[model samples]
Each structure stands twice: as structure tokens, then as C-alpha cells.
Target: MDSSVSSLIRTSYLEQPSAEQAVHPSVYSKRKRLIDIAGALVGLGITAILTVPIAIAMQFDSPGPIFYSQVRCGLRGKPFRIWKFRSMVVDADQKKHLVRNQAQGHIFKNENDPRITRVGRFLRRTSLDELPQFWNVLMGEMSLVGTRPPTPDEVQKYDSHHFERLKVKPGMTGEWQAKGRSNVKDFEDIVRMDIDYQRQWSILYDLYLIFRTIAVVFAGQGAY
Candidate 1:
């Protein structure tokens, strides 16, 4: 983790949970981990191939680091640094106040955010910026198919019911990403879909979501 993200880190000592506290079956399934590992290996391979070209475009478009890392709360409110190909001005975080957030509830977003660089816009629209997250999946902090990770600030706003979304590991794509990501502006809807995923989850369902995500990506639908 970078020095900037280190300060926001929340490392905790987790204890064995009681039967009632158990999460979804997918959370601890060995088959799921194997799938995650296989998918991450392929994703990282793509990331590796694109790294050089993406870095060049970023530097040419705006002078800054090639990658961006930020603290995000994972399963059970544990914090980890989420990585992405830099898609904004180097000081975008510092200039956050200059931009107005259009999304409602806990998250922040702007369709026309001025902080995004020219190359960054393309990366985000293509979902290429998320390629690096495969590493998070491989490291066991995330999954190939699951809920979206919440930022520390976002998690702080979560009530008891809201915390249910975090019961599963965050994913590269899930219900929202596969279906309504582009048009779903409300956070509550995301929460509902997340809980629904947990209820309807199965290995086959995960594979379906993964395929749907690929189609969504190719169609260039959804994503800020």
C-alpha cells in the first residue's frame, strides 16, 4: 500500500463466527476461490499487456503516475488499497470539492466530472481501468463475481441493514455491473441487487453474471 492509503487502513483481528453470523455459501467455498484464481490470472495477463500503452497514454494526456490506489472497505469493513489505472488528474482527490457529485446517497460520481483526463475517460468507459483489480481478487480481498467494494467514507454511512452488502467479498462485477450499472444512479438499488445476488447465488449464477458483464463491456453500457 502507498503512504497515502496507509493512513486510511483498517486492519482488524477477525474471530471465528457463530453459526448465525455465517455469510453466503460462496464466501468460503473452495471452488469459488479456484475460479477467482483462474479468472484473476487471466485478468492480470491482460493488465500486464496493456500496462505500457496505458501508461504512455496517461503521461501524454496528463503528467501523472500510471496507477492510482485508494483505500476501500472490503468484507466486514476491512480496508484494503484498491488499484486502478489512473483516470483522473494527479490531484483529483484534492480537487474533489471543485466537482459536484451527481449520484445520490453514500457514493460520489459525476458523469461529466472535470477531473477525468482524456485518456482516463476512455479507460473508464471501456472498463479497462478495472483490470488491475484482478490482483485484489487473487490476493483474496475480492472475488470474480460479488458485491461492489465500498470506500471507507461510504461504509461509514451504512446502517445495520446497509452493512449486509458487505457480507460477501467485493467483486470485479456483480448484479449492478451486469445489469443496471449504467442507469442505476441510486445507491439503495445497488444494495437491493447485492442482497438479491446473495440469495440467488450459485456457481452457475456467477458464471452467468460474468458473461453478462463481458457483454455489457463490449456494448459499452454502464460505467461512469
Candidate 2:
């Protein structure tokens, strides 16, 4: 949580137009924060209820920590630890060199990555691995709706426009997640949608996206 973000993200973003002008009003809205808190409380309750079963399954599938935490850039490129249910082998990061990246730019994805345990595969497909992120939201490190948090390494390669996406806190689900996440692998397309979301944002719109995310998760559409 005390981690410093890549200088690349902060240095360049500082040179852009003032955040007050570039960032959306929703970012500062008390009403939005209230919703995020309410949603996070409910989400954490669900996660608590599901944790036992998920933990058992994960332990049986692979002997490792039940949760995974990684540092990700948040608003204005502030670095914070993002949490998730464990979705891969214990040494997944160490073995990353063994997998081939299929997505373009800094984002990395391999639907068939061998490091994922059998239970991990299902967790990823259902997005159950993300349940732990409610804690992040509860801690105010993430929003209920905003851009996906990019890793510090990923931010190091970002262009000027990409910095705009970091003006608000990262989210548990956002434009990319509401749309089909698997199909939207191109980093540029994700950046466009994120910025568009900021432009189109309203408190009502955020609620709509949250419900849409539930539908997408149930449908199991475009997850890997």
C-alpha cells in the first residue's frame, strides 16, 4: 500500500491539464462514495460467505495462499495493493516467462495459461477470483465503477492519454468489465472506453453498469 508508482505515470500525468479540469465530477461526489461504501459492505459480506468453500476448493486444487495481492496504480498513479482470490499456482509470477502473451501492449493475457490451477481456471472464468477486491473498495483504494487498475510496470509504458484513465480510482468493474472483458483485449480500445466512461458518467450510470456486470457474470460471457 505504501508502494511508489512508476515515475513514468506520475511525471507525465503531472504535465497534463489540471486534474480538476480533466477528471470527472463523479470522482469527488460524496454520493458516489456513499454508493461505493454501501456496495462494498454488501460485497464483503458475500465474499465472507463464499470464502470458506472457495478456500477449500483452492487448497485441494493447489497448496498455496488463498489470496493474491499485487501493487496496482490507482488515482493519479498512486500505488496500492489490489487483492484477489488466488487464481494460479503459488509461483505463477515466477513462471510468467513460460507463458506467451496474446494481448497487445502492456496488458498481458493468455486464456490458456498453464500456470492456472484447475480450480483457478473456473475462478477466473466466473470472476470469483475478484471477490477479495471488495476489501480494496472498502479501503477506498478502488471504486465500484472506474477503469481497471493497471500494474506499475504496465503504467511505465503508457501514453499521455492513458494517464487520463488514472484520474479516478480504479474499479472492481467498469466499462471494460461491463462489456466483454475477454473480447476487449486491445489496450487502446480499453483506454477509449475508460475515457468515454468518465465523459458519460453519472451516479445513475454507475448503478446501471453494476447491474449489467451481474448479468455478464451470470451469463459467463467472454471470460477466461
Candidate 3:
């Protein structure tokens, strides 16, 4: 509920399509939900298999909780707690201002962030840190493929057009993740990609992005 995001939402209301037009058809929405549920069920199984080892490594590498959760803006700019594996020091947020962000705009990114632990770096590189988000997807707070959710602080800085990305549920992997995620330094670029996904969304497109995500995760391209 930042002033800037609120203003953006009001402005977007005037310029964007009506709710009926903006929303996907019922059939498409239902199919997407089914896909999300199926994907999350499978992903949770993998998460269960990896949780023990990952937890042990995280504890040994950095003393903190095994899971990390933060408030993120989701569909229609609603706030939700997005979950992930703890890939950084427990005080990462407290010390965030101590380091400089390499990325442009409100989004923070530091390729060589000191807050990241040894095991954390590997988790980030392989995107294993995002495994816990499958629960979010299964819980209907997120989608399997959609725009990456933004932090409340980041959303506070958004312009009118940037709010368009919040039309759909946020995703664990999306067009940004499928493309050069780390290389995208500008927050505008991320917004553009998210908006693009929204405009061009289809079940097949989502599947394609999901497959692309697997390849990107395996290759570890453009990941810090």
C-alpha cells in the first residue's frame, strides 16, 4: 500500500482494459490452475527429497532458519508471504542497505553479494532456493509460470505501467527467468517482460516457459 503503487493502480485503471477483458477466460484460468497444482505436487516431492541435505548444508554454512519468507506483491497487487530456502545470512535484510545494488531501479541485485553464504550461492546458481515456492503455488498464492513477484518496497517505487505486471498471479519461473535473468539489470526490463507474458499468455506458452526454466536452471546461465 505504498503511495506510488496506489497512484499507479489508479492510473492503470483508467488506461488498461476492464477487469472482464483483462482477466483470462475461465477455461484458460482453470487449465492454468490445474497445471499449477500438478506442477507444485511434483515439485514438493523434489523439495522433500532435497530438504534434509539442503537444511544441513545451510545450517553448517550459515546459522539461520532453513526457510526464508518475505512479503511480496502478488496478483492485483495483493501482499503475500513468498517462501524460499535460506540462501543468505539471517541478517541479510538488516544489512541490505550496507551493500550497493548493481541492478537499476527499486529491485536489488548484487552478483557478488557478501550476504550470500557458500551453500547459498550454489542454491542461487541452481535456483534450488526457489523450490519452497512450490508450496506457494499449490496454496494458490502463486503460479508455476508468471511474472516474478516484487517486494513491497520495490512495488512502492513502481510507475503506473509497472502495475500491469500484477494482473496475474506471480510465478516461480517466468519470462524473466527463462531469459537472461541476471543480465536484466533494469527494473523496467523486468516489468516489460512480465507485462509481455500477461498479454501473450496461453497454457502452451506457460508450458514452454516451464521447460525453458528447467534448461536455464540446469545451465545456470545469468544466475548469481
C-alpha local distance difference test of each model: 0.85, 0.87, 0.84
lDDT tens digits by residue: candidate 1, 76-176? 76788899999999999999999998888887879999999999999998999999999999999999999989887776566557777777999999999
Clashing pairs in 2: none
Better of 1 and 2 by TM-score: 2
Sort the predicted structures by TM-score, highest score first.
Answer: 2, 1, 3
Residues forming the 10-long window of minimal summed lDDT in candidate 1: 8-17
Per-residue lDDT tens digits of candidate 2, residues 101-219?
99997799888989999998899889999989989998999999999899888887777678888888899899999996877878998998898898899999999999999999999
Best by TM-score: 2
The deviation in Å at residue 99 for candidate 3 is 0.7
What TM-score goes with each of the models?
0.91, 0.94, 0.90
User: What RMSD does model 1 have?
Assistant: 3.3
- Which candidate do you rate higher for lDDT, 1 or 2? 2
lDDT of 3 by residue, 1-224 (tens): 45676555445444555652254342258889999999999999999999999999888889889999997877766777899999999999899999989999868899899999999999999999999999999999999998888877676666667767777888998999999778898988998898788777888999999999899889889998
- Candidate 3's C-alpha runs over 4 A off are 1-28
